[model samples]
Target: MDVFIFQLSEFAQLVFETTWLPLVIWTVISFGVWFFLQMFENVHPIYQYHTRLALIFSLPAGLLSLASIHYISDWITASAGDGLTMITVISPIDISFTQVEESSGIPFMVIVQSLAVAIFFSGMIFFLIRFCMHAINLKKLRKSLNYRPISEMTSLSPENRGLALATGKNVQVAFLNSEIIPVTFGFRKPVILLPDTLKSQPEKLNLALRHELTHITQHDFFSHLMVILTEAVFWFHPLVHRLKRELVEYREMRCDNIVLSEASVSRKEYASLLLELIPMPNLNKELSVNMAQESSNLKKRITMITQQSKTKPIPKQTSLILLGVIFISTALAMACTDMQTQNVFDEEELDLMTNIDKTGEQGFHEIIIYMSEEEQAERHESKLEQLRMLEPEHIESVHVWKGD
Candidate 1:
C-alpha cells in the first residue's frame, strides 16, 4: 500500500506539474478567441461556433500530441548508441512516507498534490454522476415518446415544402403533451419534439420545424454532447462555462441563419416568432438541444437575424488570428512539458544529479551514492548489486549502473 501510494503521488505530481501551465495557456487562448469575437460587430455565427469548439478541443488534442511526441523522441534518443539518457534519481526522502514521517514528517507539497488530485477527481465524478442521471432521465423520456412520422405532421405551407426532405430520412418527430419547449436529440435515430400547443398552429409549427430541422441536419446533438463532456473535465474552469454559453448562443444564431437563408420567412416574421416564444422548463438539457435554450440570448438572436445578411464565409483576418493563437499556445505547452521532463528531478536539496557522471560513455551511466558516517551502506547492498547488473536496454530511464 505504501508503494502504491508513493507511485500514485509521483504520478499525480508529474501530471499536475506538466499540465497546469498548459491549461493556463489554453485558458488564456480560449478567452482570447472569445473576446476577439465579442470585439467584432458582426462575426458569422458558424465561424464563432467552429472557433470556440477548436479552442475547447485543442487542449486535450495538443497535450496528447505533444506528450506522445515528447515520449517517443526521448525513447528514440535513449535507444541510440550515442544519446544522453535522462535518469531521474529517486531519493529515499521522495518515496519513503514512513521514513519521512519518522524523520521530519511527510512533505507539505506531497500532501497538497494528493489533495488537489482528490478534489479534481471528486468534482469530475460528481459531474459524471449528474450527466449519467440526466442521460437516464432522457432515455426514460425517449421511451415514453409516441413518435409520428414527419409526413404526418400538421399542414405545411408551400414555402416550407421539401424542408423535411432536407433532414435525415430516418429522423422522427413527436409532440409532447406538456408545455415544455421544442427539443431535438438522439444519434442513431434523431428525434425532435414539439409542444402540443404548437400542433394547433400550423404556421408556428412550420417555423419551429425549420429551426429544429436545422439543428438535426447540422448534428448539433453530438456537439452539445461534447460540450457536456468538456464541462465535466474542466468543471473548475469558469471560462469553460462561459464558452458553453457562447457556443449555445452562436449555435442558435447559426440555425436561425440557415432557417432564414431558406427564404421560408422574412426577417421581421422570424424576429416576431422569436419574441413570441418563451422559455419553458426543459427536462434533460445535456441530452437534448432545446429550441428555447438561449432565452437569455433571444434579443441578440433577434438582432442578428434582422441585421446580418446571409451567412458569410470566415474572414481571412479571423482565420489568421485563430491560427496564430493555437500555434503559439501549443508551442509553449510543448516547451513546458519538455522542460519538466528534463528538470523535474533536479532538486538542489537532494543533489540527485551530482552523482551522475555525464563524462562517461554516451549510452552508459554510473550512479554513485555517498552515505554519511551515521548511515550504513550495507543496508542497500542487495539493491545496489541489482542496479549494477542492469543494462541500458532493460530500463526505462536507461543506462544506469551503481559504482564502487
Candidate 2:
C-alpha cells in the first residue's frame, strides 16, 4: 500500500547520492534526439514511421534511470586524507553566485537534487490520476457494451474483416450502444466497436472499418499503451509531449495511407468520413483508438488524405546511418550511469573542529542524548522546541557516517 502512496525517488536518492544524475542523462538524450530530428526538413520514410522509431531510440532512457538507483558514494575520513587544505565556507544553501569554484559541489548538488525530486514526484502523481481515470472510464464503457458477432456485420464488413484477418488476429466487430465515437478496442481477441449510429447508414461502414482495421494492422493499440506509460514516467519533461504528438500524428497518417491504397476507397470519401465524425462525442480508452474524434487534428488529417502525400521507401543505407547515430549516442549516455561522488573535507580544519577529543577515543563526538518516550511521542512541531529547552549537558550527538 505504501508503495502506491509515497514517493519512491526520495528513498532511491537517499541510498545513492548521485541517483539524480540519470535524469540529467535522460533529459539530454530526449532533447538531443528531438532537436536533431526536427532540423531535418525531409525525414526519410524510415523515420517517418516515427512512432516506432522514437520509442526504439528513447525507451532505453528508462534502463539508464533504473541503473542510477545503485550509484553509491564512498567517503574517506578527513584525517586520513592528504594534500587538500581546509578553507571552510558557509553551508551549501548559503553559497553565493560569486563562489564559482568547482570545489564547492554542494550548491550544484542542492539545486539539481531538488529539481530532480520535484519533477519525479510531480510526474508520478499526474500519471497516477490519469491512469485511474482511464481505468474507471474503460470499466464503465465496457459494461455498457453488449456482445455481438462478425457474421451479423453489414455489407462493408467482408473487405474490412479480410484486412483484419491478414493481421492474423481473429477480429470481432461489435455495436457499442453509446454516444462515444468509433474505436478499436480489446487485445488478444480484439473488437472493433462502432457506434449504433453506423447501423442506420451502412454505406459509411467500409470507410470506418478500413480506418479501424488499418489501425489493427499497425498495432496502434499497443503503441498507445506504451506512449501513455512513457508520458506518465516522463511527465515533467517537454520532449515527452513532443514525442507523444509525433507518434499520434504519424500513426494516424500511416493508417490513412494504408486505407487510401485500396482502389475501391476514394480520397474525397475518406476526407468526408473524417469531417462527418468530428462533431460526435470523443472517447479515449486505454489501448484503444478513437478514429475521427480528435477535432483539432481533423482538418490536418483530412488534408493529408486528400492530397495523397507520397514519399519514397527509405534506402537501407540511410536507415542504418540513423540507427547507428542513435545507438552510439545512447551508449555514451548510459556510460554516465557509473559516475562516482565523494564528500571531501580538509584535515587541518577537522582537527580544530573536533578539538574536544585530543585523546582520540572518539574523533567525531563525545556526548549523546536519548529522547524520553513521552518526548518522542510529542508532535513534530513541538518536539524541536522541547529539545531546545534541554541544557547543553543533555544535548544529543547525532553521529553521521562518513565511511570510505
Highest TM-score scorer: 1
In the range 173-249, model 2's lDDT, one tens digit per residue, is 77766655678866566677888777786667778878887777767787677677777866766766677776666
Per-residue lDDT of candidate 1, residues 100-154 (tens digit): 3354655677767677777888999999899898888888888998997776655
Q: What are the models' TM-scores? A: 0.74, 0.62
Instruction: Give the clashing pairs for model 1.
Output: none
**Candidate 1 deviant stretches above 4 angstroms:** 1-7, 74-101, 154-164, 167-169, 307-404
Poorly placed runs, candidate 2 (over 4 Å)? 1-21, 40-46, 49-119, 151-154, 177-179, 285-287, 309-332, 339-404
lDDT of 2 at 203: 61
> Lowest-lDDT window of 10 residues in candidate 1?
92-101
Alpha carbon lDDT of each predicted model: 0.69, 0.59
The numbered model that scores best in lDDT is 1
